[model samples]
Target: MASSLTKDSATPAPEKTFLGHPIGLATLFMTEMWERFSYYGMRALLVLYLVSGGADAATGSQGGGLGYTAAISTAIYSVYVALVYLMAMPGGWFGDRVWGARKTVAIAGSVIMVGHVALALPGQISFFVGLLLVAAGSGLLKANISTMVGHLYKGVDDPRRDSGFTLFYIGINVGAFAAPLVIGTIGETVNWHIGFLLAAVGMGIGLLVFLLAGRTLDPKSSQVPNPLTPAERKAVIVKGLAVAAVVAVFYTAVTMAGMFTIKWALYPITIAGLIIPVAVLVRIKRDKDLTPGEQGKMSAYIWFFVAAAVFWMIYDQGGSTLSLFGDKNSERSLFGWEVPTVIFQSLNPLFVVALAPIFATVWVLLARRNREPSTIVKFSVALAIVGASFFVFAIPLSQTAGNDTKVTMWWLVLIFLMHTVAELCLSPVGLSVTTKMAPQKYSSQMMGVWFLAVTAGDCITGLLGLAEVKMNGVGVILFQAAAAALAGLAIYMYRKKVDALVEGTK
Candidate 1:
């Protein structure tokens, strides 16, 4: 059956790159690069815009935000990030069972472009509409693009698999590296809307590229589920998009209802939404066809979900907690030139680009020696490092007291370096684990479930930030550090069992 699709079958060889790697691989990389650029560029500004208050000469507004307190803004930002990932479940479902990856990506790209354009418009109406489209579009793009990348490999064991993914990961960082500087500069120097407009333009480039070369996906691999029947596909898409729209409306209502303004409503609504999915996951555990090994892996995956949520709560600090810390606590002058805080956000991705190649060689060398740490072991290290980075922040807090004197900027540099290294251990590997452990039928939805942790983490991280404002600053850093360390400890304690579950894979 596999040979039927391939042009060469003598040795039963798999797909080959037009150069040295699969052609499809490059297409997905560029498409995702622009998509990530749009997402991260917006992220670079989100918290700052929210907290700094978007007021500027062109915006012609004072206190440039929705007038929410810091905590409320963080919570909103967290939930928005979470929902973008969570929605991917349905987005993947649409791609796998309805549109196929190609069409799904195109539609998603176009919609996201529209969303960015809407964000360029003024007023709450535009803001809400733009966010809704962004969430929906991201859902459509996120999982499908990864799925398409998997299509480039003929089998799970392909040697180029990890390298291809690593290359693809590089593309993501490339976009991330460029975004904050490009959009941040425009938004900070000229207008916030212009920054959003730049994101829309980036998405446009991605859309054009994907549309032009989309046929690289033809004779589509079995990895992609067959397209739905015409009638069935149409019905599912219409129904799915409608359901997504409804979900967006609900999310907007719950998230925008500021905590202080309506704490009672937001709390219950958020809890209910979170609990429902967890309950569904629990029900899946009882399915009879799943091997015990599979069940065990899924259970471990849940813990991973928890770990990732915790990880992001700390890791995503680049945009929120870290950004604020830099703004107020650190000395930002580089040779007497003060740079925008947003530019500082670009540091992690820059470090990633510089270090990922070195790390990839290290992993391969370790794997060859049969000494590569188990996925859970790597995750433990990741969490531990992430937790430890907070101590860097604590140094500034302890030393900066009683004076207007600034802490050395290297403290921020050192912290981001540690965070980036830990991410090399956790984030990409975590996503890879989801693709590996998930049952074939549930791949995309499960990936979405994995991202749900991110959403949850974002919410919790905001709570942590709120606590920082109210509690002792050094104490806050210590607490976050403790949380990350505890997460690593939990995984370390379960290492034996978790290792057994993910063995021979992940």
Candidate 2:
């Protein structure tokens, strides 16, 4: 099947346009929006649900939580999120070599829906199983969808490309914003299982949209970019099985020795998160078929990837650390009704929805004037801005320490606002630059490679959660802020060299 698909020629760009871009963008946008709705909805509830003690007899309230400590819950959260992105490598590989992006996305979405359904079922075993399934599905879906968006453009230099990505980004945040408001409320105030069920419905809608409208997409997107030979397929399967077997054996040995607590088990994932990118870099560098320009661009991409990882390491805390802070440390009263902590999760995506168009327009205008900042510059600025937000947050946290006084929820709002701005500077631009930088044969795989930044950052965020248990919140925030700011400064100092390596990609 893969060999047959490889014979098809690249499809021409569609004549139809959605808001002056390719019509396929609309299909992808709706599909991704609903996919995110499912993902973010579940995420908003995960940590809180894990730490919840079920059914307080005094209050006659029912809560079916796992009763895990914050440290354990956060460790689990980190590993889950990290694995979600880490799986993107194989997802992209499957899209490029086996099923093609269109079919891969369809398969992934179905798996995600089943995962959510599993979470909706009763039992501790089912809950863990659900998480594993969802993470695997998300990893498979994430990169391929973004790759399809890149396919909607003429080329990397298409004037519409960045704005298209920014618009697509808005779709992502729209789902993210709505998910918490809808799913978070249900999960926190009502039955958690019902909330999980709703998430499955969202994925169902996403899959339906894709199946119905997918033909409008670039026909080439449905063709395997690089089909593997029969021998290569056997080799890949054998290697994959061997690795899985090794991991299973090691984990079994640790469990037998009584050293396999959840926190301890996560160490391998954390190490792999750090190591995989380095290995990928080495692999890309050794690709003898790559032109000098592609090699140089890959070099620049490494710095960008590191910067992005740092950015996500902080930004992703909204689901874990910040969610806990909202629950325990913030004043949630509004007109005598206490707000759900998970509702606060909506703010970042809300800001993104409100801000994306403005940023998109600004970039287009700047490009017209030939004054658009380079991707490296944008990344540096974003890092510093995001770091500054943590500094601002630390100020308020310091004042409220050692006392029962809770800070106003407005502080979190302020932080999310800053994060949205910083995200505008980096995320969409990162997507655009990635598509611009990749070699044709390795296109989808490179998109998967790009997501490794998120994987590494998320892994670090989990590790930091452990530290946060021992240290005061202020100290952790301060340390993270300093690290981010220093990274931004370092990138700024080397911006010229990085830009040169990009070879005029912007």
Candidate 3:
């Protein structure tokens, strides 16, 4: 008799625990982990290094900065992040139509390595070119890897699906946690170029792993299931070109971020980028009927995106405002050894490693009791925890005198601990939600869309970090608190509608 689970029969059955946890799953996990390490390692230092000039001295306040000004750095960071996710949508499309996931991932990895190498170069032009390359590679690679993971499981309901993704999720954080200590320390304390070079090395490892595994795993692993005919391919190419042209024109007009200008033009463009997808989702519901079951699943995805944006906005402060906070405002000595402000970036991932299993167990127990919170509820909690952590900065803000006050290292630890709890509630589950909810035919595209929320949130964090520099430490703390509150309220209010949408589809 056939097994009750459809996934059991979805493909040629493999023995249990192929290479310790299903061959396909293991491969994707390793690849993503290394990629995240490179990405997060850079992120861990980007804001701190920029705002503080360098990471050596404990210059906590705006007074201690390198002098380029926070506004300029924030603008550069925002544009870089925005472009990163923006590239992903097309990257996914390219993989689906022409190259397939494995090849696309390899190509993207190679490109990213080159970008990191460029960042290691010592010129403004190289910096710009490196960032551009990194963004392009991220766009191309991020979505495809997750889609490949889903393909490994064969069907959405596979019993191994959750565990497979869980393992993969762990990989993401492992790299994130390690980057700060390894790359951040070297870059800030020793040489900035060292960190960039390390990032390139991480990408190289990821590329090698993916290339080797692609050949040994499923024969159909990289095959495009649906090939477009000439006319259809032509139409897609035209649409892509048109979108690129329009976005390029829009970018050109508002491209004054380098000059520290946040123009009105960005508002409409950002809005449209978000709204167009919602419009497509609505159309899918109204015209396509898209099964209430499927609609509900996808609504969960939208909620995940919003909630994640909130969580990341706060979580990402580690590299931006928080780094500055640690530098000038907080006390940083431990057993006669002074800690580099950028090194604090390691806390969240460190906490993740320590706390992930606890949260996972709570979830499993809750699932057993049939009392698990909906994805939306968990996300709300994540936002609340993330937002609440900023209040801790307020204490230091009041105590410090632009670098005179010595705040305890424990305070930074406390804030990261809270953010860690919040992340545990959000990040891993968010990845799973996206993978499960999106249609198989559009898996990577939807994942790309989901990542756009992260990109947007990172941009917001940079903007707010700059605002903190301008308005003073207290102003930054209050701004973050307000954003978190707003995001939490929005999620709670919309919970029912979103829950219904997910339920109807499921």
Candidate 4:
């Protein structure tokens, strides 16, 4: 699977530079920054808007919400986010084999802008349509734009590659950090639709930047790496339509049967999320192209995948469970002015921006001393730290149960800080390991496999939110904390076996 990321050694490097890297870096940086602004901006409001009741006729209070229950709102949020990631696989495929990276990104960005516009419109039909469009568009744009960034570098061994990615990463967090403050404030205080319109404007700016400056990007990025033959293209179209037909028929049948409630709708998605990864792993293991050593590494990668899924299941609760808690249970008063709940959503990215470099330096210092933890150990530590963060929250919730007391905002801040630390340990290392351990023949597909972990984790998070609503919230948090900690311990117990299977790839 040749990709835009794989540079041709024979091609000459570009001479024009920006910030000591290719000039195209700036184009991509700005584009991704604003794209994230749109994404996180809307995300900050999604659940809050869904659960809000616009105004109480009796009390004359200001409110503009759909008034869905917490469980339903969380479930919708989970499905929306899960589908966003799930689209990455096909998005990458379209970039690599059909439209090429640059074109796919340009088209996808346009779609995303339109999606945001739809979201800004009034009515439930428009809201649902907007979610679908944004998910589809984001799926296409996210992976391909990152691919374009890699294309800017000369090759795998480019000395500036890591630094370039670091700069690119900062763009992501910058957008994420700023979005909630700007969009959240407006959405919570004024109108949710207006906030969504602002998100549209953000994406529009990204698209304009990309369109004007994209020519500076590597020309190879515009070349389809594996152009399909006309016959193959027709076959793909036929297969796609067949799949769409099957889905439409199934949906119609379920709707007619009156078995298509929100909870029931989630069952199929959760089942698919659980099953797809197992099927992918089985297929990879059965591939005759892999050597026995590669097969062993595949087995080891499965462990890492499971650990990552567990990690994201807890970490992504920041948007659903954590956001809800912030809105309902956290004290928002500051100088007699109430703060918006969505502002707390900014904390994770804020911490990520601040802590990433420090963690990088620590890793380097540890490596120089030959005292760096192994990949498995780092993963175990991440799970434990994140789980413990929740445990920390659980204590406060348990003590405050059945009372009107609101916890201080500092508690949520502390949790975000801890989550950032765990992310640094696991997320980047997980990406590095996926590339290192994947069988050469299936490398591109392995990236898709990695994203499936996120999909699976999010699906599980939605299901757990329902459970949290039904059972005691404090008890559910304690159970999740215990489960995560035990998962970490299990990984540690089998560390030696995993290390052997990985065969020194790390």
Candidate 5:
């Protein structure tokens, strides 16, 4: 039987225990929130740490940093951030084929904790190695955790599903919202290594809580719905190990040969980023099990994915160039206290925390009234808004600041708010739709497919930030704006057709 209901449907209707969702929701919520705290905490400090100089702090010298040029620092940031999402492919595969989501999340969480701890140690070797560990761990954990959240729900059309994910996303922002204020301040004001340690402690707490809430999930919650035979498993493992070994050796050779530039890493990442997600969509559309309707939905999803990549490419600058601007050019006075530059990183997540509930409610009310924006419509709006944000910043480019000009804080504030609203319109909705439209057999893998766009976006965002070392910030912002506006316009023009394909879900 081609069951339209999800794998979890046979279980009893879940009792409402946490905010009108199941008790397990709370566990995943808390785990994800704290995990994000660690991730974003580290992220808020990463680029700043890289570009900082040493042996002085009184004159606002970014001393004690890695002391790299902005270009190289952002390049490194781009690659690390790209891999964080790119690795989700193999991580999701492992969960679906072998370890199951539970073990994958547990193992990945531990690895990330260790990575943060390593980052706290003083040395260049520790820094790179710690980044590698954290990237790999995040790959293994992120998509799978979102997959597990989907596992807790049983219906494709459950009214509460989007809201549930919305709540889960709110938890993510709570962590994100706090990370800049806590770890970012610590890294920026106190000591960089101490900030890293704070991140590690946050992850450790999340892991402990996850372990303690062991029974919150259904006994089989983490299992692969389509388990492989022993022969199949053995073949997959052998192939995976061989690939891993080859990649490790190739990168080692490149680094040793002094050929491992960001461009070297980026070229393949860009290629694979396109290949992976396009291939996933192709496979999904061609799946024998999908009804014609499902195939239509899959097409709509491809459009949404592309739209999201556009949104993220522009949005990610909030962490990179925007953060740099805050550190160097933006006026940081809030209530007459000079805010630490790291505080700017909090704006997106802070807005997300404030905006998500309203968006969630808005979606439901519109759905009930048959006035809901089609997902494509929401995506187009996101694109236009993201573009406008850059345009907004672009307008103030020459505003009388000679390496000392604090452009009105309102400029950055408005930009962050626009980006956040775009993200609210796009991100959680994307996560929900990935769960809804994905084939049951490849559930977690689809989440990975979605993140591949993020991987590409991060890479591109880095390149854009890197260009600021050579290019003017105003020109860069204008480029971003034009690109997003074009993409949004294209999608908006074809939205009626898109709406038809996405007929089943809002």
Candidate 6:
């Protein structure tokens, strides 16, 4: 797959630009940084806003929450997160099959901004509408953006590729780290609507940065990696639109009929999430066009994706369940200042920022001696780390008398550190390998499929929120930790088989 690129954008970049990576890194780095700030900032406020209606009646809520029960709020969170990942499939397909990644990203960013703006408005209609837009837009932007990062590197085996992704991940954290400090504080202390407005402004800035700097990225990023014929393009577009329209109508009818609420929306969302990747896998496995090696790579890729999703299912709680824990259970005051609970959401990104470079360097060093862990092995490590974090977090539960009792900050801090280590082991590796393993013709689409791991996990997370474990009790935490650990270990035990399946990729 080659890009139809402009000459100016394709000019040979200096080898040592942007801390020894391509010049394009600066462009994507800033864009992703601000986008993440917008995302995490808004996410930090969601559950809090949902649950705040029950906050101290005397003092009143900063913006008065939606007054939902924990289960309902968490269900909404799970669905939104799941949709964001699930939508990326078509978003990736659109980029690969129709509009170029550059255009897809720009359009998606604009749509996301619209979502944020709508969220700034009060009322349930605007709220759900806003979440829908943001999820759809994010789906389009994310996989394509990550794909563009891979395009900047020289080749599949490029030594700097992992490092570049790590740096990009760092850019993600820069925004994530600051969002809580800025957006979290204001949203918690002042007004929820104001906080949402700030998120919109942040995305607007991100879009502007992307337009200005992204132009300097490899021109190949602007062209479809695999160009389609006129007939193919028309067929895909028409079918996509028709299918989307029908689904939208059916969904709306169900909702307006009172047979559906935001909570029940998960049924469709989860079905879509599972179906997209499975369909893609079927396509890959059955495609006569692919060589045997390509088929093996796809199988291995699926295993890694499943493991990554398991890790994410645990890691994602940072925003949903762990968030409420920080707000209600963890001690919020630091040196006499009342800390906004949202600030705790910053911990994982903060750890990623501090640790990513070290991990990148370690991988580079290990690769020199052929000592680096295979992608699958790293995934196992990630699962163990996150599972352990939960177990550690759960240990203190026996001491607390009530859900609101304050636990020490180190308990949460330790968990973030553990989760961050798990993330480092998995996130950058997954991003780098997806581009490497995908068949060239379907590269972008495959990247989107890979995100189905998150899609599956998020769907399950929503359902899990409705379960007894929504807020971690001793039983819930222990079971979750054990399940993830066992899953990781099971994968690790099959490392030899998984490695053989991906030999062509390596």
Better of 2 and 6 by lDDT: 2
lDDT string, candidate 6, 1-506, tens digits? 24546765788875648988888888888888888898889999988887777642113346466877666677678778888888887788778877888889899999999999998899878987898999899888986888789889878799989779878877888899999999888988899888988999999999998998875788888898667899987887799899999988998898789887655565666666667767877887788888888888887888888888788787888887777776666666789987778888888877877887799789989989998888888988999988998889887675663544567766877888899999899987897789789876676466676778887777677777655244557777788899899989999999999999989343
Pairs that clash in candidate 1: 17-21, 53-64, 54-64, 55-64, 82-455
Name every residue pair that clashes in candidate 5.
53-63, 53-64, 54-64
Tell me which residue pairs clash in candidate 6.
none
Which of candidates 2 and 3 reaches a greater TM-score? 2
Clashing pairs in 2: none
Give Cα distance to truth, residue 100, candidate 6, Å: 1.8
lDDT per residue as tens, model 5, 167-270: 89889889998998999898888899999999999999899888899688755656875578999988887998999999899999999999886566556665
User: In candidate 1, what are the lDDT values of residues 1-506, reduced to their tens digit?
Assistant: 67665645555656656457788777888989999899888778776666555321112222444545455556556656766876777788778776777788889999999998988887767875787788789888987887778777878898888778778888898999999999876775567788888989999998888888776754463234855688986887799899889877876886777533434323543554467557757766777778887787788788787888789887876776677566656777888887777788789999999887788789999999999988888899999999999866788877865555677778888989999999999987887798888865565467677777776776675454334252226777788889899989999999888877776675
Q: State each model's C-alpha RMSD to the native.
A: 6.0, 6.4, 6.6, 6.0, 6.7, 5.7
Residue-by-residue lDDT tens digits, candidate 2, 60-114 = 2236888776666777788799999999998888998999999999999999999
Ranking by TM-score: 4, 2, 6, 5, 1, 3
lDDT of 2: 0.86
Q: Which candidate do you rate higher for lDDT, 3 or 6?
A: 6
Each model's lDDT: 0.76, 0.86, 0.72, 0.85, 0.80, 0.81
- Please report how far candidate 4 places residue 137 from its true position, in Å: 1.2
Candidate 2 has a TM-score of 0.87
Per-candidate total of colliding backbone pairs: 5, 0, 18, 3, 3, 0
Candidate 6 overall lDDT versus native: 0.81
Better of 2 and 3 by lDDT: 2
lDDT of 3 by residue, 180-247 (tens): 88888877777777888999999899888988877545556578756678999899889989999987
Count clashing residue pairs in model 5: 3
In model 3, the runs with Cα more than 4 Å from the true position are 1-19, 23-26, 52-67, 154-159, 235-305, 401-403, 432-445, 462-472, 493-501, 504-506
Off by over 4 Å in 4: 1-15, 54-62, 256-259, 466-472
Across residues 1-506, which tens digit of lDDT does each residue of candidate 4 receive?
36644667557876788899999999999999999999999999998888777321112223666776777777778878888888898899999889999999999999999999999998877888898899899999987998898999889899999899989999999999889999877877789999999999999999999999978899988999998999999999999999999989988998899887666656677667667777888899899999999999998998999898889888888887788777777787889988788898899898888888898899899999998888998999999999999899896687657766778878888898899999999998899899999999998778888988888888887776555362227887888888889989999899999999998765
Find the 10 residues in a row with the least total lDDT in model 6.
Answer: 54-63
